[model samples]
Target chain A: MIRVDHLTKKFGSFTAAGDISLALARGESLALWGSNGAGKTTIIRCVLGLLSFEGTISVGGRDIARDGKRARSLIGYVPQELAFYDDLRVWEAVTLFARLKGVARVDLDATLDHVGIPDQGGKRIRELSGGMKQRLALAIALLGDPPLLVLDEVTASLDVCGRAELVALLGRLSGQGRSLLFASHRADEVTSLAQRVLMLEKGRVNAEVPVNQFVAKLGAGSVLHLHMPAPSRALAMELLRGHGFAPTLNGVGILVPVPATQKAVPLRLLAEARLSVDDFELLSPRDASLGQENHA
Target chain B: MSATALETREAVEAHAPGMISNVLTLAWRELRDALRARSFLLYSLAFLALGLGVSYVSAASTGSLGLSGFGRTTAGLINIVLLVVPLMALSTGAGAIAGDRERGMLLFLLAQPVSRLEVVLGKYLGLAGALVACITLGLGACSLVLALQGGATEPRTMLWLAGLSILLALSMLSVGVLVSALARRASVAVGTGVFLWLALVFVSDLGIMAGTLAMRLPVKSLFLATLCNPLQAFKMWALHSIDASIDVLGPAGLYAMDTYHDALPWMFGASLIGWIVVPLLLAVVVFSKRSPV
Candidate 1:
């Protein structure tokens, strides 16, 4: 649904997005994962025709630079910061955007309902919580039912439940044959929702991994640091292996590699063993890899 | 067969609205917001009170007033309008696009099918609508006061003044929108717009006057020099309204020329058109090329 070819953005001597090329197919959910200043926002802006850049960006077979208005009409953009008229009610905001998108007034309520904010028509923007505001922005983006949706850090401010809700909404959107390009710094958020992941570093597409493989490589293996009260390291190791953990006896503690999916199984096994566990911590492998990458 | 055909017709009948209607709807929303704003209402009220006071004082002081007396009264009112109306237009225009950018609402507006030209025109028209209402109320109140007194209040004069005010406001608004498009901050746009207005209205005239005096120019040349400023066009137009008996096409045509005659029409029209077109052209160029934040 979208093609970005060697897109590069420069400000004086600084390069924001450098020679990045990627494509997203219809109904595919791709997440742009990166650290801060990774140029994700810059790339999104270029695609939106907001910023001038070198190279080409095409949306739904139309070149954004050549036919910006027509291309934009086929794409829905949800910016990181959910900005709207604070005084406008939910319905007013949605209807305004619908009108701007050239949607008939009759379709506005249906669009609002589609975004899961059905009964919030009269709620003022200021009165809504951060999650609701984000939903309102999503509803605005979805006003014309565009084929492609671009979301930037949409789950940044949401609580766990809200993030789950948004993930479910994204899943449904992708199920409906709509392409989604989401950019976020939250690894877990992307891991749970994205089908494919694009990792960026220093304005470059450093890696592209399938979501399941990425989770397996980065999340499948985790470190379990356990301190036993009785200093029964050998017994703890045996108990850990019984629970499917690759355990190593180190001094008075046990270090184990636990598969992420079996995280609860090990904990349950430890509780069943009745071992006096002084302390335990689940160390995510992705966090460790990211730290090493940063150090390198 | 009939039911199948009915379903096909129903599907075909589902239509979306056109883009122009959408732009107008958005523009109407902006107009409503401006009208409901306390600052707009307060500014209009202040202008009305000041206009009434000036007209009342001018009418009371003059006795056995001839065409010259009427000319003076109208000139005073025109001066007030030219000075105050541009200031109002500048403030309103300065915030037009920059404010939206700051609040990030510009993204929401632009996300639609509206082109940059449509956005600029819609905003200009919306602000112009509010400006017209305010100018009408203020100018109409002054004209009413003058009529209540023994002064001659011509309908044509009112129409001309209103028309001139709109042109002037549009010009100032164009300049303001240009600044807004260029500046990253609303305050900077407002400051730059105000500075440009002062330079165009007062500073440029002062410079021209100094140059004329330095060259030891004739009285006629000095009078003609005033025409270089748009405010002077307004002043000349006001002068013609005061005394219609004066021969506007004679050698001393500065005072004699009809306010709407000959080159004056083209002069105001060009100035107004230039203000609307030039800045907007530049704005489109800059906005299209610049990256969205």
Candidate 2:
């Protein structure tokens, strides 16, 4: 459990996180949702006790300033940057992190297997694909099975499949009763993993609500991604457009913007046309990684 | 203890540190990073090449490729190690901290349960490890060539020179770590390291030479001033060990011998150790005060 009271962070004259107070209950998953420069990272940094802030913060009841080592001991962190060391093998890096975190015993093989990277222990970090690197970062975060996990932009660099797989793993973690505090701009990730979403705007916690209500209240639309074989791409786009939806071709598949009100209509139209979607997720409007938001 | 109690105890132990273990782990990472760095390797190899060149040249000139030839090579190899070792140490020491900061590695490391002092000490020791390895490789290669040519007599003098050079490298590494901690950017940190090297190696000597020519200070004062620069103190100490009446330090050594009597060697040794300690403590202070962001 993490508790932050009146947390305010400032850089000279500009406030990064202003008067933001929130608490993440034990075994309760919470997500910080914000656009760029919205103080999402500042809030997380404050919770991690990395920044000088005006407030009280504690992890598992121990104050960060008074007992920082113990407070940090209760938390596992996955930073935004996936770099540990380029030359170290995947398993070696994990072992080093476990030691660095002072974890008494961690089954490196089990940790790697937990992240679906069982054999990457021998492979160098630089040799890993983006997905594997992210997975390795997660494996490192899971060391000693710390009670709290703080992940910053977890799906920022992953492809759709990688994102889905990671989201599923996180969902399992959520179900197993580990406190999760994640920061993301992706509404879909918030919906899938976060039980409660704290919407931040300009260093302020503007709203805190359940993910479904948060998306519904904002009238934000979700983007439907259709993954078909190359030959069926044109037919799917035509079928989508015929239903008065805007369709765009991405590298992997065609993306159709579906508003919350008419979300059912588009999916039914796709079904009616027999254009199969291999996988799909209701992408929140601010899912910046998937594609640029369409204001039009 | 019960199973849950045992788990709690291990978790508590994992978070607890009086700083030694944390520093060692960090130092190990630092050593690995520095040894793999191309700049550290390049500077070390340059020292190595100089050592090889000096060994064979001294052997040829002495007309004896034995113990006498190896002893003679020390005089020339000392200068090369003095110049090359500091540069190599700077690259590894300053580059390690600055690169970590720039790449967000420091932030990640600090986010763990370790304290700020642990990070600095770990990095310093790691760089020291790399520097020692590099010094051994370079100076050892030259010695190996001499031994191969049947010259193995003056091991004591050879070792003394190598030891002083290691001390010299450590002194500069401390300065480099301080620069790396204080500077905001990696490029700036490296630039400061180079400038410090230039100041200590070239500028200080040139300034002293100019001042001495202009003012004509007393011999004792001049001698004290020369020892103020670690490189000069190191050079004097290395050569003085071989020839007591060595005129390499010009008038300072001779005059100091007469005026200071038994205290001159102690002064040189103290100055070299001072150079190593002062900057390193300053680095620790700065690191402890500032956030690792």
The TM-score leader among the candidates is: 1
- lDDT (Cα, tens digit) per residue for candidate 1, span A1-296: 77888899998989999999888887888888898899888888888877788988777666677667777888788877688678887778777777777776546567668877778888889999877788888888877678889988988888899888987887777678788998988878787668898889989998889987766666567876676865566676787776567776555466667775665665677778777778877676665445445555
Docking tier of model 2: it is: acceptable
Model 2 misplacement above 4 A: A220-262, A265-296, B1-18, B64-71, B150-152, B214-220, B289-293
Least accurate 10 contiguous residues by lDDT in model 1 chain B? B6-15
RMSD of every candidate to native, in Å, equals 6.3, 6.6
Candidate 2 lDDT, A162-229, residue by residue in tens: 88988888888778778999999987889888889999999998999987787675545677766667
Give TM per candidate: 0.85, 0.84
Which whole-number lDDT from 0 to 100 does residue A146 have in model 1? 84
- The lDDT leader among the candidates is 2
The digit string of per-residue lDDT tens for model 2 on B1-293 reads 33233234333323554478788888898888888888878887888889999987787677655655665688788788778877777756677677777777787777777777788889899889988898888777887777666655477877788789889989988888998888878899998888888888899989888888899877767787888999888888877777764476668877877777567678888998999999999998887666676
Could you tally the backbone clashes for each prediction? Answer: 5, 2
lDDT tens digits, residue span B1-293, model 1: 23233233322111234557756876787787778778778878878888888778887788548444455666677778878888888878888888888888887667656677677777777888999999999989888888888777666776787778777777777778788888888889989978987987789777866876699766556555655455665655555555643254344354435443566556545656766678778877777655434
